[model samples]
Target: MSDVSNSSRTTRKPKGEGHSRRGEILTAAERIFVEHGYEGATIRKIADEVGLSSTALYMHFPDKGAILQEICRDAFSRLIAANAAVADEDAPPVRRLRRMIDGYVDFGFAHPNAYRLIYLTRPVEAREGAQDMARELGGGLFTTLEATVADAVTAGDLKGDPSVLAQAIWATAHGVVSLMITKPYFPWADRQTLVDTMLDAMFAGLPRP
Candidate 1:
């Protein structure tokens, strides 16, 4: 009985331990990937970051690409959730759009490593799963922007081709976030000041009906 109990105890994992370890791996991987580009961040390095053997790390993730995919997937899910809140709000299209922009910027700032990985890194064609994630998440986000723009145009709150307007707005938001992440050393206005200035400029250029 004692032998059997010890074996059972050794084999059984404490509840949530696996999930906690995975989170730690992801956190360490993100820091490594950000500090060293994807190519430089090998599985061994990531394993070392988390104080695990490479073989043990492989038990959790098949390869570095899987880790990247998981990171992107999680980040995109959070972004979608944040945007969904604004989109679902019972507010004017213009208001919703502004809130979405704020949320997008906030997400970038909140998850700088994930943001850089998703946006700054070149697409990894080898990772089909990651590519699929990018397509699905990116497409959904863009569609929401387009639909919001269409609604605004329909309501006579703004005037422009919905597709073009949505693309422009996305590009502008991307630019703002990318610059803020990459050029932190540059002397710039306060974050909210920059966001407000950009939104005001964009709204002014976009014709109102």
Candidate 2:
């Protein structure tokens, strides 16, 4: 359900397609969620969209809520792995923080649908299981970022309250990804150049001890 209109959907895909109907369902659901909104999307509609019956869809995901939860869980798990690797590296705190920020941007472009579901969702629409990702996995991501910010502050390479700086950095990165995603039609600079310039400017302006 990640994107609504796919070639696979032209024919009703039987149960076995690459041994993982789960991916297709998720992709389809992403599109459905965007097109129909969460409440408007139902098991039957999602099933039809994915060329499966409601029963078949249930076999992959117990319900719509489960699908949303799995999307959130899978996304957070990937982000955590990427973040842990950067945070563990024996690099300058500022460098590690930059790399982590780059990785976050990379993730948003690489999996836009999952990114939207995990970050862009309105609280009420995402259901309780989905929000749990925020309380649990989402908190872990922020903690890692904040820890890195604290490290930089302690090293005198970055000047600001660690918590405040961490939030500001995350917000800026999110701004880049969200704006690019939601407004592709907008005229923008080359992505790499734009991101590099934005990062350079932000870090350069930050007061250092």
Candidate 3:
């Protein structure tokens, strides 16, 4: 037989290669899901995109739903971390609100796919399990925001009800980010311009001088 290289064929992957491979698969799946939506994405397509056979992919993820769950959980966990990192419990009310706003925007822009997957995708009954996980993942973040608003109310720095203020802030930031992502080409206004305008208007209307 002709001399041939066995080193290339016999080399073993690094110890963490398995986890890296799963991460790669998840990245590929997110791209496909964003481009094609839930129904259009398929395990076969994800496997092909990642240069894996379908059987190899299934070894990592039991099914497409499992992959989706993993992705959603990852995204939600990031949201919780991002919010918690900035919303200091002892900070002044206005400062906490500003930090929360900054954190929200940073997370959304940094992980556009994750933001869209969590905020924009329509819910399905079959995936209701992910909803519960989302609440669990995000409970801390919400609690942080709610507590800040409650503190502000108690200090008389803010006039509105805490829950209403919390909800309004969430809606305002989410609306701005969602519109920018989903309708970037819309002729209404520039993204930063609109976001800044909203922020300034929101602060301008806050309870005191």
Q: Identify the leading candidate in terms of lDDT.
A: 2
- Give lDDT tens digits, candidate 3, residues 1-209: 01112131222235567887787777777777777888788888788776677898898999887887787788777777767766646778777787788678767767777777767776772263356556767666777888888877887788777788888888888888888777768886766687788888886777652
Per-residue error for 89 in candidate 3, Å, reads: 6.4
Candidate 2 per-residue lDDT over residues 1-209, each given as its tens digit: 23557555734655457346778777777777766778887988878876777887787778898887877888899999999999999999999999999999989988887888888887888663667887799999999999999999999899889989999999999999999988999999999999998899878877788
Q: In model 3, what lDDT does residue 146 have?
A: 80
RMSD over all Cα atoms, model 1: 8.1
TM-score of 2: 0.91
The per-residue C-alpha lDDT of model 2 at residue 58 equals 81
Candidate 3 global Cα RMSD: 7.7
Predicted candidate 1 versus true structure: per-residue lDDT over 19-117, tens digit per residue: 766776777766677777778889887776666778977888998889988888888888888888888899999999988888888888888878877
lDDT of each: 0.78, 0.84, 0.72
- Candidate 2: stretches off by over 4 Å: 1-6, 10-19
C-alpha RMSD by candidate, in order: 8.1, 2.1, 7.7
TM-score of 3: 0.83
* Off by more than 4 A, model 1: 1-16, 124-130
Give me the overall lDDT of model 1. 0.78
